[model samples]
Target: MEKHGAETYGELNADVYDEWHDIDPTDAVAFLAQLVEEGPAGPVLELAVGTGRVTIPLAAEGIDLRGVDASEAMVARMRAKPGGDRIPVTIGDMADVDPGTDDRFAMVFVVFSTFFFLMTQEEQVRCFANAARRLLPGGRFVLECPTPDVARYDREQRVEAHQVGVDHVRLTTVRHDPVGQRFLGQHVLITNNGIRLAPAFMRYAWPSELDLMARLAGLESVGRWGGWRGEPFTGEGNYVTVYEKPATPAS
Candidate 1:
């Protein structure tokens, strides 16, 4: 897949994007903790934890934390942060990741849009299989991906604009190719001083496709929600899925 050889956007604009979406982990601590209650501050693995957006804060929670991302540039950028030094991160593809030997995690997570980075259906399934392999018996794998049917793009074009700081604002327009089902186009970061355009692209998978992948990985979906707040998995609600490893059966 192109994702393997492609330059990651996070690595390129780490500094700029981090400044914009500096979500407080403390704010979502309760939410994430609720998702992986079984993990209980045990080994927690975060996949594609770029720029420490969630890993930094999760580490602060005092849990055993490990993160992995495909882009070394992004990993290096994350390492440069205040708490980033503390989190052990591996630079490699999320699919078929091995965090450590003899240290399987109680919970594995792929947050934000990280799941979409896998451009191919097979690779996405492989990622699930890999996560399952890294989990302890009865451990849980939590995932968050936007429901594919939420909004269909006629030609697939949308713009997102947000203020990064007092004077800087980033405007991104995602253009999808209907034929190839690939994300493409340009993201323009405009400031009072000037404007910089960065090209962006990705491939997105449907929720059903993800389900098949999880099933092939020996995971069963036990929970679904709209948002982190535990909203019902309506067609409109974002897809939040929980897959569990089979518990060691009593002898």
Candidate 2:
């Protein structure tokens, strides 16, 4: 494999992203819509908004949702979806989210562990700061991230079955760099049509580390949950966390 850039994952996976991931956005969309209802009046922004999975539905329901993504291919796929082209999108890195508007967002969010794609603590911190800069004072920043479970791997490497179908099978290989908190993954899909390899790189951070990042961006944590349905976080599994920019900056 060659060195992967910020846009590499989306560029490679755009065509099969939605199908392969096959996640239901119902709960997530509802959770976000509720936030918008309680939030201040302003457009909402999504970072790493590949294929408008959550953005299109929010816009269809009359929410002023916009997006920023690094991969033109992913954005193009989104534009091809129903109501996808209507939402404004800026082609840019999530670390430097810019929608080309002076208006601040009521909320800014990145879902599905996409924030890990920043690949470094420095980039992730920059992303938090950028999200802060784009929000209205007192507005919210939300992140839907899974707890990184490194114990699943053995000696920094692991392989497992991802999907098993009558005519197709998929296996995933993972290599971990514990020192850097980075993971390199490759998905092997085998079918009568031959085999395909989908690769991705991510740098995972713990919730405590993320809280510090938010603080550096001048935001504070207001909520954390085990899921979007508001379950309590019990030190395991996926979590949805909300941070707010203070209405008044600290002296």
Candidate 3:
């Protein structure tokens, strides 16, 4: 297995990320905009805000939002986009850096399985703690991640062709470790010119584990949905969860 960290994904995929992973942001943007509008009074922060996919759009909608990303390469791409420069951004590890002592957000969010990029239980817990510390009392931390599906692996490994075109083909290969709840995978893109590989590692947590992490960070589970549209979660493949810090005055 190759050794890498949070920045690896952006470093490898930044150039082609927006082009290859483009998804209509209308629904997600609308959902999050409403959340921010209804929540406490403060700016919003997004972790791993690569290419400003969701962040840029939200900012356009008049949300006061800031972003933090580990990769300068990714941040640069976001900076080049229109209105991207208006949104404050920090280049640091989301799990460890303080956005600002004076700045507190009403909402913090990690979307599109970015939570799994932390790659270990310890890092993930620290991420939750960091989010909590950056939020105002009664603030919300929202995470969107795919529910673990070990069944997709056969003999602990699986490979599937993701895309096929006349000049290019994309394939995904994954190796799972049940005990550690980790998925080590690589995306292979083969073109007429050559081949490119983008590797990824994730330490997945069960819903119960997520709840415990939130509790440790002084947050309580407030909502869980199967999708961004507020569909009820029923052990689905992907889900969104919201955790809120208590509004009670600190003793």
Best by TM-score: 2
Error of 3 at 100 (Å): 4.4
lDDT of each: 0.73, 0.92, 0.88
Clashes within 3 Å, all models in order: 0, 0, 0
Of the pair 2 and 3, which is ahead by TM-score?
Answer: 2
Q: Give lDDT tens digits, candidate 3, residues 31-124.
A: 8998888889999999999999999999999889888898889999999999888888888887874665479899999888888888889999
Q: What is candidate 1's TM-score against the reference?
A: 0.83
Arranged by TM-score, best first: 2, 3, 1
Tens-digit lDDT string for candidate 1 (1-251): 34434346666666666665565555355667665665534588888878887788777767778887777778888889899998888777788667755678888888766687776667787889999888888888888776654264554677777547788777877776655556765668777889887655566776777778878888877787786777787866456778888876333
Candidate 1's error at 172, in angstroms?
Answer: 1.8
Distance (Å) between predicted and true CA of 181, model 1?
Answer: 3.5
Question: For model 2, how does the per-residue alpha-carbon lDDT over 142-185 read when each residue is reduced to its tens digit?
Answer: 99998999999999999999789999999989999999998999
Query: Whole-model lDDT for model 1 versus the true structure?
Result: 0.73
Error of 1 at 134 (Å): 1.2
lDDT winner, 2 or 3: 2
Query: What residue runs in model 2 are displaced by over 4 Å at the alpha carbon?
Result: none
